[model samples]
Target: MPLKPGANPYKILHLEKGCTDKEIQKAYRAQCLKWHPDKNLDNKEEAERRFIEAKEAFDFLYDKEKREEYDNREERIRMAQEHHSKRMAEADGKRKKLIEDLEKREKEFSNGGKRSADGSTPMTAAQQAKKKKTDQRNFKEEIEAIRRQLEKEVNEEVKQKATLMKTEREKHQKSQEKLTPRLLLKWKTSEGLDYSEDDIRKLFSTFGIISHISSAIEKKDRRKRILEFESGANAWGAELETGNAPMPEITCEWLQPPVETVKKASDEPVKSTNTGANNLEHMSLDDLEAQIMGGF
Candidate 1:
């Protein structure tokens, strides 16, 4: 006989039904190792067939929709079998009762007992209706059982797929977090000097792409500009080549951001006891003299 739905896959993988995804994967690997055509030189054809069967089974069970459908079909087949068995039992019981009634009628006729005018016993209308109702109820119950089993299997498959997807997404996100653009070169200029952004870009553009050029020239601070290259190689090349260039006033180095230090709050407040300095404008001439004397 041909294998039923959801039956051959588990057998092919050498696993019990309802095994976890991890177990399925492990079994697949083991099957591949054992039945690989390269390893079975003497029986290449058989090994190749087994390997293909294992792969197909794994593929079917690995997919949620295909697995669920298989499970539902299996459940329906089980329900049908149970219903058939019940029907066979009912038919057998009816046959035995009819045989007993026939034997009893034969004994009565031999004993000269009076028979009914019709001379045959038939099912009453109520009994016939009751039997029909019972059969309908049994059929409905079997269908409902199959439906519930299918639903449960579907829900479990969905949950498993969701968990697998979540794990894969988290792994992808972590890999993305590990990758970032390379750092750019930052050069600090000497105080009391002037350097334009255009001049900086032109100076570094020969080596590689200049992503950004920024200059900060103010009254107190001299010109400080940053040249950001597209890649680290270009930045290193610019650093090595520009060392002997004419521009000696400015220094070129990799710029790193300053680290921030967090200060903890103190419980006690600091006290200042310079009342003379606090009220210097309001102090009188004698007070000023006394303050000056105290300081001496």
Candidate 2:
């Protein structure tokens, strides 16, 4: 039986699209064997219909021109379907994007552009609190580090200053130690009376033990005199007490010894008082015997 126009011959024969002519023939033979009227006497009518459909499919596919036309038509229909599906997919994608955009805007509007509309923060309250605590801890650590650095610097500066002061003090004390307990005195009396060295010495003698007193022999420096004390403390005391002077013109000042004199004094060697008998005590027995033999 002839197939109706637009009927899919490949479907009737259970053949795949783009099947070769040999494959179509093989499919038709197999259908005929399965649905022959003689092979199915009890279901002859249905078998005959199936058999006729298969025969019509074979006839249509056997004609190369008709088969090419059908294939072309099918290809055209398939292309149209694919084009429609592509358009539909594109439209769906656009629709989805528009919906997403609308939802985003709506969500933003609902939350005043800050968060989602569900009144939910991106992080939980506990998480936010923990982050805040971590940040605070880091800030404190930085501050503590800075404070420690500053304190260390300050302590180092103070220590350096103290060390410097100690060194300066030691140097001053050494310099002071080199000075003798002596004071230089000069007087311009208000009464225009000449004060002898003895008189000046007698007046300052009340402060401490006076070692000696001498008047300056220089004619131009006739008012100048030297007063030596037994001790530095006495010399300083006398200087302090006589700072105002008996008549405001008798000034006393500490006398600094010359550096060369002090160095010379320090470099002087001690004289040994060891006699021959005194040396004998320190002499080795061999050396004493050798000395006695050498003298003989």
Candidate 3:
């Protein structure tokens, strides 16, 4: 199935990236059952749409090659977005500083300080208002200019980055999988009450696409919430950015090594161990029966 633009197969299937084939199949089946038209008679249209979406996601991700390409593209896009955000933040800081300096200068002028280098008197209220208006307009213009320049730079860099990624992907087509970073985060408040998943998304959505959020009660009656971002970088970014935010004043920690890795490790085959009967391998049937009965 052809993948829809801007559609994320992992999110559609409710599975994280690097999930095993069996996990994908299980999620697909769950989605199929949940959204089956017969099961959602009252909302058949929406259900059918979701059902088709699930199928498309399954088909696209079931193919190793296609899924790898999709993942690589998503990574490139996320990196570009983070770069752009960082640049814009720097520009905003500079803009704020400029505004502060302007305000300080206006305050100095208002306090009867020399208005000009040539020992000029303080301006009247009318003149001050005019000056303030002009300064504000100039500040706005400067901010707009900075925004345009940053946008241009980001666009050019993103284009170059995409081209570079393509070339690198071709060169390393058969390379081993890279180490996946931790994208799942544990969130909880000091009060031990967790926010709803929708509320959590509203708070952290600006940082990145949230794949899932689950709430649970841990030991000692502590309520815990696990927030999963589609990008590990975004998860880390959210942790850093939310530190000073008044809302969502809760604590967050990246779940180390990611959940998918833990699942995969647990799924590995263990070495076979000898049974208790192996101790009596040398005994005859009658002797083994006698020994087993005695042991019992």
Candidate 4:
């Protein structure tokens, strides 16, 4: 679906230049669970918006080519913030040192020193020169302090306005699915144009699009299909307007070497019951894969 309003994750999960592909996916799913609209129905529109945003977030950061672009942009943002902070810190230090210098000079002049070079007591000329220097330094230091404080306030203001502007936008609409992402996929089998739920689940689930237990229900005569979600909550599939499952371009063989040492994530693992984390809202690629592969 086209991203919902207030759905952007520009502020939610941050992706650094060093984030790995795995980390991007993990961060996207985690933030989606927290901000998904279905789970927070009281604010349905906002929730839906966030859901789309999370999807967009996953798309941008997970796609290697696109992720590079996003990482570059994020790095610029961090750099700007860091630069502003550093400037302020330096100004503060300068202001403090100037104040201390002025105080020390005043104490030295008051303590009664030797006479001036011209045979005059060290009072008038030397003290006047010292006082004038101190005054000029104080003026510059105070102005710098004010400028830094203003910059700090400006940065904070910018952040606040950006936040307020986001939440003020309308929530996401599912109708925008016309702009749905094109699923990059190849046939599950070379010989059979059909997909085997077992292997298909293993592969696609590893990627995040869970195939339904119903395999895929299609009324080609009627041009509609109903597919079950891993959540057991049935939704329209094949009907991309609803939410079509996306598959990857590469075959399983091209993915990675086989794993002989896989273990269960028992605590946060997927449970078949409608009562557990396997529900639509919390399902991750791993969770969906296990569900489709018959949890075997």
Candidate 5:
């Protein structure tokens, strides 16, 4: 008759039967922000718990009939509680009457006016020994019960400690493995020289370039560009030491100009025929072309 949960569940959310749909929805959202599955992915138990709470709230609020049923059930539970409380009070009164009767008997015995069936005090040694033995057995049984309970608790505690130590050992081993040395760089034919991925990227960054240095073997075009850039850079560095300008670099694009632009400028030589000769239409790089046309 009495309503009682054997243990506390420590729920993340609680909803009452009388709660409005809007109120329930608001509570669900507020709880999900902190206890959603995605938010607690690392804790499978916690994630499942929150998921279950959210689902329960949704199930109760989504259907009108189900909600009405839940309300009825809660009312029944409240009535049952009230009845149980009344029953407990009645039982307590009866128990008090029984205990009073027992006390009345105990007091009559303690008045020390009892006599044996033979109308004389008799020393029954065998009966007294048997009673003492029975008392000892009962005491021993109580001690054994306590010992078994202590043993069960000790075993459970040991298991918990073992599990925690295992987790800690795994974590420690992972850290040790990560600390071990790594081969950060290795030679690849297309890359030309051995350098770590970070170091190669650093070289690209130094030249104000933000390109990805992909696997040179898998990506041939990236490999060629890297080699060409490195080669040209090395050559220019050499000429700079001798106090002389670097050699002119060549490209396929420079050898061919846009025919339409060249034709447009060449045909419309309206003013400054010489100025039109060195127009951007005939050059790949305006700055380099300007320098060349200036005098050198």
Candidate 6:
């Protein structure tokens, strides 16, 4: 079976949860040495099992992606536990109320001689009291059964929600991983001002090889530019350096594209153009101007 959130990898490795990666590695190595089958010749089978368990724990904790998944699972488990606890408390309160009501009914019956609602005695008071007691017992039993069933359903729902959340998170992570390297460069320029293709190239040349530069469609007034880099690393580097010092007279910062934008970009068919300048030409002047002024 797959390891669930309740199964602590750290426990298997004999380390505390949230331990440093270095600590985990150290513990794993020690366990491997201690449980090596060759060293435990008298109990090779037990030693092998322990060794595999330790190795599996280490593998799950070592990977960044898997570790995140495990953390989410643990969080979901905690939430479910909290929900169960609260529901149980409510059930206990209801049980107490039912007991109180039964006692009150018994007092009323004693005072009123257990008469029927029509004001005529149905049986002797003792017989009527016994019947009431039986009814109360049956009611309590049914309530208990319902509470148990509700608890079971709630637990199942929580588990299902957790599974769904994990699946969606994995899907989102995959989509983010597949996102192309792109950077939005916001710049400010006076009205009617424009930068030539060569000039723009010269300005961003220090950053990285530019894949494409287009006016920001969203910020026409600001003369913002979206510069796509051949690599994300280069874009990140440029963003960092630009923040430290102004890129010439122009001020700019990097903007992360929205998920929708990234998805759209990923889906759009790539077109071949003869020249980099032609890429800008194919776009309307208004659109190009908007892209340029878009960044600040």
Give the best candidate by lDDT. Answer: 3
RMSD of 2: 57.7
Worst 10 residues of 6 by lDDT: 270-279
lDDT of 3 by residue, 1-296 (tens): 23455688999998999999899989988998899888999999898778878876886788787789778878977887797788888988998898898888677557654566676777877777888888878888988988899878978987898797677665443222221222223334554444566767787788656666654434443344555555332233454434334433555544322212211257852211111112232233344334333432
TM agreement with the true structure for every prediction: 0.35, 0.37, 0.44, 0.38, 0.31, 0.44
- CA lDDT of 203 in candidate 4? 43
Candidate 4 Cα errors over 4 Å, as ranges = 1-47, 112-120, 124-296
Give each model's whole-structure lDDT: 0.52, 0.57, 0.61, 0.45, 0.40, 0.59
Higher lDDT: candidate 4 or 6? 6
The superposed Cα distance between candidate 6 and the true structure at residue 20, in angstroms, equals 0.3
Residues forming the 10-long window of minimal summed lDDT in candidate 3:
270-279
Better of 3 and 6 by lDDT: 3
Candidate 5: count of backbone clashes, pairs at least 3 residues apart or interchain = 0
User: Which residue pairs in candidate 1 have backbone atoms (N, alpha carbon, C) closer than 3 angstroms, thus clashing?
Assistant: none
Tens digit of per-residue lDDT, candidate 4, span 1-296:
12223333445566655677677777877877787666897897776655556665665445554445445545666776787778678778877877787776766566466664577666675666778687777777787768878777877868965774454332111212212111212233223234445643454443334444323322321111112233211222221221124432231111111111123456442211111122222234444444444422
lDDT of 2 by residue, 1-296 (tens): 22444578989988887789789878888988899888999998798777766766776677665677667756855675576567556655655665565555444444433555476755555655565566556655655665576567557656765685566456535544443455556655455556776777678877667767764433332455666665333233454444334453566654422112121257853221111111132233344344433432
TM-score for model 3? Answer: 0.44
Candidate 2: Cα lDDT at 293: 39
Give the TM-score comparing model 4 with the true structure, all chains together: 0.38
